[model samples]
Every structure is written in C-alpha cells, then in structure tokens.
Target: MNIAKHMETIFLASVVIVGATSMASAAVARIGHAAPEPKVYAVAVEGAPMAVVTVSAKRLSAAEKAAL
Candidate 1:
C-alpha cells in the first residue's frame, strides 16, 4: 500500500511538470506569432547610373510616410 501511494505521488508530480512545461511552450509560441514582421529596406547610391531599389509590400504609417 505504501509503495502504491509513492508511485501515485510520482505519477501526479510528473503530470503536473509536463503540463506546466507544455503551457509555457504554448505561450511562447503565441507571443512569437503575435510579433510584427521584419521590415525590408532597399538601398541605392544617390547618383549611381545602375541604381535600382525594391520596397517591401508593408504599408507605412502616416508619420513614417511623411518622414520619407
């Protein structure tokens, strides 16, 4: 009976630890998913004959547009 109780305690502790770890991983994944995408920039020299630039599809905010 004593051994059975010990085994039960061990099993419950393992379950709790696994559940907590899974919850933490899921929260981290959700935070990563909610993050903003990285911005892409195109660079060019001012007076270069072969200068060409491509911009990302992301829309700029009003302040950002005004600054550009």
Candidate 2:
C-alpha cells in the first residue's frame, strides 16, 4: 500500500468519527432533561479584630493609560 493513500484513509476515517461524535452529542443536548437546582445555604462566622492595614500607591498618569 502507498503511504499517501494510507494517510488519506486515516484522515477521512477521523473526520467521519469526529462528525458523528459531535452530531450525537448535539442531539443529546437538544433532548436534555431537567437537572435539580443546587441547594444553597448561608454560612455565618464570628469576625475577629483585624490589624489596621495601610496601602500607598501613586495614581496612574494619562500617558500610562494610553500606553496600556
């Protein structure tokens, strides 16, 4: 068998496989069933005193914004 012909066959087979797989998955999505909504609950925790934090930064200039 020729190498080129073998590769062509393999590529065509892969294309068919991918197309069928995608179509099947799409059909399944169209027939989707209702999924139960997740139950959520609020959790509370005691707050502890946090140490004072300080942040220092210079405002960006108009030139800096334009460059970005």
Candidate 3:
C-alpha cells in the first residue's frame, strides 16, 4: 500500500511538471511569433519643416523585402 501511494505521488508530480513545461513552451512560442510594436519619431530637417516618421521594430532582409 505504501509503495502504491508513493507511485501515485510520483505520477501526479510528473504530470504537473509536464503540464507546466508545456504551458511555458506554448507561451514562449506565442511571444516569439508575435509582431513587434512600431515606433514613431519626430524629425526635423535642416532648413526644413518637422516630420513624423514611423520605424518598425523588426527589419526585413533583402529576400523578405523582395517577397513582399
């Protein structure tokens, strides 16, 4: 009986650890694929007017740009 109880405890602990690990990995995957927020900046040209520029957090490679 004692051995059975110990096995049950071990099984429950293993299940909990696996569940937590899966949840953490899922969250990381979502964050990895998430889009970055765009940044806005105000710029002033020499002897010119002010302008608003938007910068992307992520830059595309040449291949990615060509695919767009």
Candidate 4:
C-alpha cells in the first residue's frame, strides 16, 4: 500500500478497462449489417443555353464541397 504500488495498480486497472472497452466497441456493426449503395437522382430543366453534360462514376472532392 505504498504510493508507488498504489499508482501502478491504478495504471494497470485503467489499461485493462480501456482494452476491454475497445474490444467490445470493435465487435459492434452499424444498423446490425452492412450499408446499401447510395443513389443519386438527377433532373434537367429548360434553361437559357446549356448543353447536355454526361458524367460517370459521380464523386465530389473536398474542395468542391467547400465551394458550396
């Protein structure tokens, strides 16, 4: 029950508690299963003078999001 032994016991107990909590968290899955693919919907409206623009494999970068 010296100061050094008391501090060592507290450190060991904290390590064990943190390790067990991490293991338990890793075993959980969101929504109890894998997520489905996200769908993107598009609609075109009549405008001044804009031609059709076709794009495949749609994706947005961080810079594009910041510009919005």
The true-versus-predicted C-alpha distance at residue 24 of model 4, in Å, is 0.4
Give the TM-score comparing model 1 with the true structure, all chains together.
0.42
Task: Give the residue spans of candidate 1 off by over 4 A.
Answer: 1-5, 33-68
Task: Return the top candidate by TM-score.
Answer: 2
Q: Which ranges in model 2 have alpha carbons more than 4 Å from their true place?
A: 1-4, 43-68
Error of 2 at 30 (Å): 1.8
Q: lDDT tens string, model 2, 12-43?
A: 99999999999999899889876779886855
Candidate 3 per-residue lDDT, tens place, 1-68, comes to 57776998989999999999999999999878777698768565689966669887998899999999
Q: Estimate each model's TM-score.
A: 0.42, 0.49, 0.42, 0.45
lDDT for residue 5 in candidate 3, whole number 0-100 = 60
* Model 2, C-alpha of 42: deviation from truth (Å): 1.7
Q: Please list the C-alpha lDDT of all candidates, in the order they appear.
A: 0.88, 0.86, 0.87, 0.80
How far is each candidate from the true structure, as Cα RMSD in Å? 14.1, 8.0, 12.9, 10.9
Error of 4 at 35 (Å): 2.7
Best by lDDT: 1
For model 2, name the residue pairs that clash.
none
User: Using alpha carbons, what is the TM-score of model 3?
Assistant: 0.42
lDDT of 2 at 14: 96
Candidate 1 lDDT over 1-68, as tens digits, reads 58776998989999999999999999999877677798869667788789569886989899999999
